[model samples]
Each structure stands twice: as C-alpha cells, then as structure tokens.
Target: MQETAVNVLHPLKTAALAAMLVLATGWSAVAATPPDQLLVGMNMNNVLTLDPASATGNDVVPVAANLYDYVVELDLHDPTQVRPGIAESWSIADDRRSIVFRIRSGVKFHLGNPLTAEDVAWSLARTLKINRALASPWKAYGFSAANVERSIEATDASTLTIHLPRPTDPRLVLYTLATSIGAVVLDRKTVLAHEHNGDHGAQWLTTHSAGSGAYALARWRPEDVMLLTRFDGYWRGPAKLRAVVLRHIPESQSLRLMIDRNDLDVAMGMSAPDLNALRHDPNVAVETVASGSMYYVALSMSDPKFADRRVREAIRNLIDYDGINRTIMPNYGVFHQRPVQSALPASLPDPGYALNVAAARKLLAEAGFPDGFKTTIRVLADPPFMNIATSLQSTLAQAGIQAEVLSGTGNQVYGAMRNRDFQIVVGRGGGGMEPDPYSNLRALVYNPDNAASAKLTNFQGWRTSFSDPQINRLIERAERERDGAEQIRLYQQVQQRYDADVGPIFPISQMTNTVVLAKDVHGYFVSPAWTTRLRDVYKQR
Candidate 1:
C-alpha cells in the first residue's frame, strides 16, 4: 500500500532501477584523494646527489631509496622476503644459471616512456660500465671479471634473460641483483637521447632523475636544499603528499631547535642524544629503526705503522665498546656484543666479541709489538662518535701507543680512509636494499677482483695480512648457492672463520635508530637490519 502498487510489471521502470544500482557501484570505485603537503628535516646536510649508483652517505640513501625503485623489491615487513616491483614475474632456466623475466604491464618511466626489457638490459650494462664509486649491495652476486660481461639480453619487448656462466642459484638472483646502487630501470629512449651527451648511469642521472619511483627531484643544490614532488605520471598510485623538502642543517643543535619549534615535519640522520631528547617530548613522536649497518675502524693495511698483527690486535683491544654504548650511543644502540661479519640477523653466533686484554696483549707480543706502536685515528666531525673516538685514543695511549685523533668533515674523512691517508679511520658501511655479508665483509676485506676492493680493509693497500682459505672457499660457495639454507650455512661459516681470524674490523656496536614522523604518516617500516623503504610510505588524512 505504501509503495502504491510498486509500479507493477513495468519493464522500463525495472531497467531504470537496475541502472541506478550500477551507477552507485561505479561511484564507490573512486580512490581516496592524496594529501596536500608533507615535510621533513635532517640534522646533517644530505649530499642530494640523485645518481643512485654513486650516491653515498647515511642521509643520501634514505632519500634515494624512496625517490628510486628497483625491478625487485625486498619486502619491508619481512626482510628476507621479496616481491616484484617493475618486473611482473621471473623464472630460471633448468640449469638455474639463466633467468628470464616478464616485464610488468603498464609501467612507465618518469619521462612518460613505457618500460621495456631493452631498458633492463641497458640498465645492467650501464652499471657494469660505470662500476660506481660507491660500494653497492649488488656487488655480492658474484660480479667478478666473469660476471661483468653484461650477460643481459632482451629476447623481445617484454621478455628479458640473463645468462650466467655458471649455474646461479635462484635465491642468489635478488641478493646479487637488488642493489640501491645499480640498474635502477630507466626509459631506454630517454637514455638514448642523452647518450650523445656522454651521460649514462651515475654521471648522467646525478643532476636529473628518470626512474618509475613515487617522486621526482623538482629541485636540487649540492650545499643548499633539495626538493622532491610526487610523480603524477607514476604507474603506481600518486604519493599522498604533494612534495618532500630536504633541508641541509649541518648543525645538530640547530636541527633540534627547528624540530622542537615544529618548523620541520621529519628529520633525517639525527644523532643518538638529540633523538633521545625528541622522543621524550609528549608533542613529538620518535621512531627508531635498526640500521642495517655496522661501524668499524678501517686499518691502513698498506701503512707501515699498522703493518704488524700485534699492533692491529692492540688497537682492537683498546676500543671500549661497552663504555661508548653507555655514554655516546646511550639508549639508541646496542654494544656490538657480536663480531658483525655479515648483517644477516641469524648468522651472528654471538652479539659481539669480549674485551680480552690478555688475548690482545698476547697477540701483540707474538707479532713483536709488545710495546705497541704510535698512530693516528681519523673520524667524522659528528658528535655521536666524538666521545667514542676520544676514549679510543686514550685507551690506545695506555697501551704505549700514541693515538692522535684527527677530526674532519665526512668528505675529508672518506677521502683519507679511501687513500689510506690515516693509520686508522672510524667509519660506517652498509647500503643497498638487501644487507648481505658480502656488502659488509667486502668493505672490510679486500677482493682483488672488486674495483672498490682496493679501498676496502682487505685490499693490498691496507695493513693486516689476515687471510683464511676456508673463508675464501665459503665466499665462492655462498655466491653459487641458490638454496636459502645452504647459503645461510655458508655465511655462518664465514662468520665463524672471521671470528677465529679476528682481522681488521673490531666491530663494537649495531645501532637502533629512532625515526620520528607525524602520526598521519603511513607505510613507515624499519628493519632491525637497518633497511628503510621509501616507496610504500605515504601520508594519510
């Protein structure tokens, strides 16, 4: 009665009613609109270098990680897990040496060109050609004289395959390929257009960017500030915030004051003490993530002052990791109780090495350096390690060693360390999407084949002549093993050997960084391994 006979049996009316229902469903399909603005601050100046292959420094990696995307992505929620990013899917040959990948559909570079397999081939070739100055995470996948053949070829527009001389394990694919430094896919046509200008990976991409990432560099000045804006043309949904602004605040106290005043939305590379103070404020939020990195003293193996094993052991024993953690690092980090060979979570047999003065002295005496030698230690001007370095110098002095502490900017410190200009240098090393022992170990151990190997602790240019046949064999086997369990085992063995040898690195601490952001931010995840993914991160209303 209320429906007034319900317009009974009218087919046209029924059709109209159905059409209205369909319209409502379509309306619900619309996506939520993104935010208007997003901002962040940093304690130190970011290099603001856009070239992923050559970008170095703690501040630079966090920014490039989000502004750039790789073909394969390591799952943030699960450090060991991985998913496809630019490439849709991949498969290995029967021998497991060659891999064929089917490019994802609808992917486009920042320049609006569709992504193709030829771009993949070009990207790999570019990385091999440049062999970037920065030690990338991908160098571990057996990128040797043999692996440098640019073995990549595009079978077709969407199909690409890479032929490895030896059968590579499937698990080794992502570990060796998923690097922050190498092969960030670009538009083949855009690169070709610039090829005549002598620009390719790092050298070409430095001032500009052309990846399919969430944002693009809108503006950048080396010593000033850099700006990033959401890529409206992104194949993935547009980022929530309209833009990201990176300020270069070289002074820690100034940065702290800025954040406290609410002038900064987020800050990058905050020191442990300043971070702790921010976390205590009720109005501010602090987020600490385990940085997938390890800081060590790089001994000049080629230097005459540190040439003896006794001297190196003496230096290692002289470091007071426990005291440093209590004072400098405070609540922000753990005393490197375990000798960190590789950053693998489970691979560490123990959290750190014990401070054994007796063992250290014995080793020193055996090497004919019972009276300890005099040397200098170089370090960054940053405060987090200022107290630690001073303590190290004092401890070495007690051992009849003259330890002169020299402070300088990051660039100066890096240059000194690379050229073996100092007897010992305090530095941190870890990068790329995946943290492999190869990444950490290679930096400390010199590999004759690696171009960067000369700068690493293992290089012939450095002091310690420490070598282990078992470790070398394991490194070769680990590179070949595709099976996860076997690979882990091989790495564990490497760790054990490293522990026994107790070479150049006297690893003292593994840091837990507190990262603070506005409550409206989403997709922020930090791994204990110290990996931060900027791609999936966005702001919410």
Candidate 2:
C-alpha cells in the first residue's frame, strides 16, 4: 500500500476560506475529509515530548498508544480486566514475588526488526536508567536503576521475568504495566543504534518511534502537526486508515467551525459551549466518557495560614461544588469530592460538601481570621480551570477572604505547585488512569517524606507539604492487603480520615472527556485511561 500525506489547513487559511464562501455563495464550503485518512484537531501545548519515558501528560497517551505496544492491555470497557498484547500470556509466581511473560512469535517492529523478550527487558530497564517523570510509578514499586537489571531479565528469546523488590500488591504492578506509557516495549536494536553520547537514544526517540504497533511516526512538528503512517508489518492487522494526521488547533471556535463544515473528522479539547452547540446537529455526534482523573483545589500547607486545620476547613467550605458541577462543569466534569475516581468499587460517594459561607465565616473566626485574608489562586488559563478559579474567588469573597486569580500555562501553574510556592491552585490531575484506588492515593494522598529536600514532585501530597502518618499508613497497608474486601475497606478508611483531617488537596469533580466526531466515523471509542487507539477507526463515506 502506498502512504498518503493528508493536507491540514492552517487556522488562518481556514478562516479566510469560510469568509470567501459566505461572500460568494451565501454559505460555508463543506469539504469532505479524505476517506482513507483520519484528521484530529486538539490543543498540543502540553505535548512537549513524545519519548515515552519522559512524557507526563494525558495529551501524549493516545499518541503513544498508537505508536507502541505494551505487553498487556487493560480492557476498554472494563479497565480492571487485563488483555494480552505483545506478550501472549503471563503468570504470577507462586510466592507473588515475580511475573513471567511468554512473548509472542512473529511480531515485527515498524523497522522490520523481529520483536523478542530482550526488547521488552531492555525497554523497561531503560525507563529506570533514564529516571525521568514517567519513572515515578516504577520507583514507587521499588524498581530502581541499581536493581532493575537483576530484577527484570530475559531468560530466553521468548521468556521474560520481573522480580519484585518489596512487598506490595502484584496486581498494581500489572495495572501499571498495562496503562503506563513507560511500559511500552521499544525496538531495542533500533533505539540503541540511534543512541547519542550516553543518553541511550533518549534524544532520538523524542521525535522518532521504533515499535511493533499499527502506526509509525512519519513527521512530527511540535505545536503544529504530527503525521503517522500505517505500519504494514504490524503484529496486528494493518490500520484501516492509510494515515492519521493530528493538527494543533488550540482555538475551540476554529475546531467547531471546521467540524461543522466537514473539513475535520474529529475534534477534541473543545469548549463546553461549542460541544453544546453541536449536540443538535445531525451530521455531528458528541460523545463523552468518564476520564479517570479529578479536578481539584490544592493548598500549600507550608503557608502558615493553611497549616491551621481550621483555616483549611474554612477554605474547603468556601468551594461551591454543586454550583460548579451544575453550571460550569456541564461537559467538563461531574461532582465528585473524593480523591479516587467514582468508577472504582473502592471509591466512596461524595461527602456532600456545598458552598457554606456562614460555616466558612465561623471557622475563619475560630482560626483568628475573623475578617478573612487575601491570597492568590494559581490556575491554567484554559476553560474549566479559569472558570473554577473565578467561581472560587466569588465564594471566598462572600466568606470575607479576598483572592486574586493567577492564570498561566500548565508549566507555570504546576511548576509553582511542584516547587511548594503556590498558596492555592485549581488544577486537574491524579494518577487514576489505572482503575485502582492505590493509583489515586499514591498520587494525591500518600506522602512518604515531608522535608523540602525530598523533592517528591510526582506526589501531589509531597508538593503541598501535607503529611499524616495515619493516612500514609492506611495507603501503604491497603496496597499490601491481599484480601480484596479488606483492601476496599482500607481505601475507604483513607478517604474518611482525609476528610476529617482537612487535607490540603480537595477534589471538586471527576473529569468526563467529551469529543466531537463526524457521524460517519466508526470504531472510535474513547478509552477511560486516555489511550484511545485509531487502528480500527474508519470513515463510511
């Protein structure tokens, strides 16, 4: 099959075309997107790097899913269930200290190199050696550069074994393997050939790909466009589409207009207003799925004001959860006040926290701030963050507290939070991509260290300088609990304790991702873990 390059119109050119069409024909032009190709539109600001070991944001999940393959995959409808991928099957050791995988035969990488167990072993070992952002989960599970070589190994061409260095639920390790981008198997030979200095191909893999997946990297221009061509020798059948082109069109209005005119097939990251407007259109279909993440308001406990439990409770009371979910979060998120995503059986129901100005004032008075105090709220300049910050500003004023909204890019807002420099922040994050309570707790609540020099930036609890021995004990105990029922109970207890202790991070809502697709598109189901695959997506006309 011959590969085709799909032309993506520049945003300005698209607007000019619309204006010309309106003036000439009294209507906009409806250009049919190519039947053999898929065009996606979304904001690419967060897609800073494509190297799986370093990629840290949701924007890179779907891209990496199509470019590489994992040993196992989480079921689309039920993430708790694991499905076989590169590894045909795997078995846990009798003592639950190791897992052995049986690598499949005849799998070929995009570069035509044969896939082997050595590739799987090297890929995971490299992830630890690099020790970047994506290595957090592995490090949490006691895997490190010093022990990774001995802990993970290929016994033969078709067999790989991974030994655990600590006591923890083996299932959590499997879940991490199934969902984490770092676990994607790389073509070791191809990658090492491109290695520069002692970087181990870290620099080359940023803009390139060497995997046994449905698509191969064709061209990538950060903040502009990415093109992927179908890999004919993919272990699975070749992708239905000849090529997939992802365009970076940050403006929601432009995406709305393009999809309306049939110039684009799929649009993501659209504003709620545009999604609501497209709901009644017959040619377009608006779909939503529960994303395993939360929208939260975090406070830095290092600040003397927030260190007081009474003041922390007062700030939590000032949030208008119901109003925000009902109005501002219509298409953005749903009301959820717990750290864990609501889909998990281990998760508890919302604790019914509403805007209580009177209660907030009383708590403030008890905390010796009868007149309230002034603070700044750091938030992303995007849709829901800014909107949530504005709502918080209004409610806080009612409680006599003055707050200024500080808006910036993801790096600006999150960087300040990571450095323990922000007073308050309206952000959306928690490692709920995997369907496990521990994933959420480890990211939001489990802080093993509280010292400034520890720099556990990956853990939100550490970032906020909030640590409780009781909460930490519960999280650790829950992870090691072998009894299913007891594990659930422990997770529930952690949430209850967090509420009573007035933890700094307060979850306001659970995220629900919405996408606008042309009606003719089929087999485009969104993954709750953000690993949406495009191998089977095709256009009818």
Q: What's the CA RMSD for each of the models?
A: 12.0, 5.3
Residues 436-516, candidate 2, lDDT per residue (tens digit)?
A: 999989999999999999999999999999999999999999988988999999999999999999999999988998889
Residue-level lDDT of model 1, residues 393-473, one tens digit each, is 877766666778888887677677655566777766533234565555444543444234544432322323445566767
Q: Which candidate ranks first by TM-score, i.e. highest?
A: 2
lDDT, residue 222, model 2: 76
TM-score of structure candidate 1: 0.82
Cα lDDT, all candidates: 0.61, 0.87
In every candidate, how many clashes are there? 29, 0
Candidate 1 at 450: error in angstroms? 11
Model 2 misplaced stretches (Cα beyond 4 Å): 1-30
